[model samples]
Target chain A: MRNLDEDTITQAVLARHTGAPDARLREIMTSLVQHLHAFARDVRLTEAEWFEGIRFLTEVGHMTDDKRQEFILLSDTLGLSMLVTALNNRKPPECTESTVFGPFHVEGSPEYPLGADVANGARGEPCYVRGRVLSRDGSPVPGAELQVWQADADGFYDVQYKGEHGHRARGTLHADAEGRFHFKSIRAEAYPIPHDGPVGRMLDALGRHPWRPAHLHFMITAPGFERLITHVFRNGDQYLDSDAVFGVRRSLIADWVVHPPGPTPDGGRSEQPFYTLDFDFVLNPLAQD
Target chain B: MRNLDEDTITQAVLARHTGAPDARLREIMTSLVQHLHAFARDVRLTEAEWFEGIRFLTEVGHMTDDKRQEFILLSDTLGLSMLVTALNNRKPPECTESTVFGPFHVEGSPEYPLGADVANGARGEPCYVRGRVLSRDGSPVPGAELQVWQADADGFYDVQYKGEHGHRARGTLHADAEGRFHFKSIRAEAYPIPHDGPVGRMLDALGRHPWRPAHLHFMITAPGFERLITHVFRNGDQYLDSDAVFGVRRSLIADWVVHPPGPTPDGGRSEQPFYTLDFDFVLNPLAQD
Candidate 1:
């Protein structure tokens, strides 16, 4: 038994468990020990510095609320978020590119019919998004549950409105027997990342940007195939090359063509204006661990 | 000018600004935008994950207090602590190696006179550490301030035992005109990184060990040189190969050789069993930021 000091404290604590028989856990712990110890030694840590590091982490935990998660944000800002996502989304092609399932998906979004309006009262460049969900073999996946969430025309989420409204342009829709789904909404705009927290402070200290490109999020699932979480980026957004969260993919970019104020398929007020958004999604089989 | 949705709410709230930007603020914002955007792109983040990340970060903030900082712990556990220390401590040879401060060391530690016993009531191997804090030129820097804090015999920092007794094995010690400093305490012991937080959970998930090797933390400063935050590792700790925070350096290891516990021939308690712990610290001048 070693007495309390800097290194001894770390040793006693880390000694509680040896490498797990499980190879994955063993690898992670091994790498973690090397990196963490190297970090401590590199700085020649002090008691005050150690405590300061603890206090910073404590603040990260306390800053959390129903709407925010500083630790996850910290991880995201530090490249861990993408690393985890990339690590997990390794299915074969023809499967829709799996992206991160962000935290703001409302359990109960206003459900719309097969072709009902998803952007009830929003204003922007109106676009008709039509899509089909299919298995990797190209068979239409009917009755597939699809959750489509996007920012308003102005690039903000409904949750940001708090008391004003909830889940705007965000809701659940189901594909018909043909696996065809269509809805009307406005194009999303690029937005910045959170910068008022410690992640932000660290970023500020190091000098970095936080802009994400425009995109619409979708989560589609069927019983046999895997739950597909993905997004379609606007083809030519200025920040496409430098998305804040790195969600862009070659296949996910859509062809959003402006069609002027043409006649709606149903022949409503034609001159109001609208755009056409078309894309498809392919899902892989589900693998539960 | 866009409306908020769940997807964009994080950015909107994070970028909520105070209008005009000064030079420093602009510089901060500019760099923040780049790195953050790159991080997002580097990982290809999505909406659900983005909100979840926000929520995680919010909790980190909620966990902060004067006694602890979860954010720093997150940074320490994540290797950011050592990264910052390394980037900050590019000193020439002979300077003490800087390291991450752990999660303790509160204010109000009683100041002790030179040659006074700092071991309090804890019992273990006795060691007398004598050091001269000098500049790079080898000249003794008179009137330098030194703050000494260490763990107890049980591999726990004095602050960890809060409510049992206050400021045990932690306090400030100043150097005499010769840049000389001495104190009597038991040789420090090995301990663990705090394992009761999200950091612990991360380690568990990663199958990582939290043990750091044994070492003593030191923060030495004088009028001209940079404030030196460093450590002296116990030579034989088995965990040196894998420091939890990556803080170990080849030069930082020290051997507090075991000898019959005895007082110094300088007319102190020659009867008490004690070991000799001696070292010298040289500091680089603080660089202008």
Candidate 2:
């Protein structure tokens, strides 16, 4: 308790947490403190730098609210969110790999029947998206619920529009008995994550861009399978190799084929050039606990 | 860039920072990311736990404002502040050891002459504090400025009273020709740091107490000596061995001798019981470039 120098203070801190009733909590706090102490010691962090970190975190926190989650942005941009996703959602190679569940996701999105135009007046070239949900054994996952959302061509999600936009380019739908699902939406485009906050300043200082590759967000849930939250990135996007959040996975990329102004997947004629994408999701079964 | 598993994402993240212009910033960020990723992998951190951390940080940020800083409290309780203080203030064995510069310190305190009662309407047993500032070689450092502050009997700093109290138990003064400084204030008592925020919740979860030992804060500065920010802890305090901030050092402890109703240090009579404390500080000379 006395004379806690830099080397011994870590042990003293860990000793204080010996009484935590929750084993998991104790383990977590122990690892956190050890690594945190090691980090401070490794960097030989100075008082001024430490104060600057505190100020940066405070600014990040203040930037968070119901509409914006700057802390999650911090995590995503730092690749921590992807790392956590990778750790928590380890799946067989055959099953779909999960990625960052970005901060723009909203609950209670309107549900429509299969093949509905989920774009809802959002601007961009019309795109028809179709996918099938299957189990790891390659069987149909009938009636699986699919929650889809994406930023419009202008690179802004409906939530980022500040009440000027409705639930555009985001909706919930269900797969058919054959596990086939389709929806009409705008073409995805590479866009920067919500910058202009503390995280943005950090990225700018680091000389890193905040743009993520063009992608569509998906969250699929079935009765007996693990929930899958991932993105289907456009195959040839420029930022695909450098997705800002590190959310890109090889298995998740799909080609967005462009067609002449002709019949669309929805059996509707499009006067303007339209794009279509087809991909399949394989869900892993719930762990046998 | 693609197929980034848990093991590879760390390097990918670090590689992105290769272009940082400031070398120090880049180094700090590199260590931070490495330790952060290692901690996550060590704990096999789950998405739920990650969300909890984000939420906790957000709450801590929201609780902070111009009047209070919850993030600093978070760092202090975790012993990071103490570690940083120890790292930045590595003095010779004989020089006074530094401790956490708590958040309650305010600039522009009223200046008072030597031996003045700085406890302006604060409630506590009257105590006389006297000390001499000396160089590490034991020579007096005359005209050293001493900034002193302490919480009242109720464990509340003047600023914690929510504007109801002006300046109480805090003032700035200069040492005299012999480097001797004296002030009249209240006897220090063990008190809890401001809890009831997210940091408090974390302490409760860890089964740790938030109390710190009784001590008087002093920031001493002389012309050729390094700035000394430290505390003279009251001997025999119950929380001495379990300071919530891990700020206790054997050399910083001093005894507060109690006296019956009698003459005070300033040649005045005290009807109530009074306490007197005598301590000396040794400052290290500033390092040469």
Among these predictions, the greatest TM-score belongs to 2
C-alpha lDDT of residue B75 in model 2: 92
Candidate 1, residues B1-289: lDDT per residue as tens digits?
Answer: 1222224423432453223244444443333433454444444555455555555555555655666566667676655566556655666766666776666655556788878777787656677788898887898888787777777667888666657665666667889999998887778777778767666666676567778788788777677688877777888888876677667777777888776545563456655556667878888877777
| Each prediction's DockQ against the real complex | 0.13, 0.90
* lDDT for each residue of candidate 2 in B146-180, tens digit (9 for 90 to 100): 99999899998999986567799999999998999
TM-score of each: 0.66, 0.99
lDDT of 2 at A3: 83
* Cα lDDT of model 1 by residue, A1-289, tens digit: 3222343434433453365455544443444444455445544554455555556565666656677666666665544455455555667867777665555567878888877777766646777788898887898999899888877766667775658664577778999999999987777777666667766675555445666778888988788887887788887888775554555666777778777676765456557666778888888877766
Span of ten consecutive residues with least summed lDDT in model 2 chain A:
A157-166
**Chain A vs. true chain A, TM-score per candidate?**
0.86, 0.98
Model 1 chain A: weakest 10-residue lDDT segment is: A1-10
Candidate 2: residue pairs that collide: none
lDDT of 2: 0.94
Question: Residue A142, candidate 2: how far off, in angstroms?
Answer: 1.2
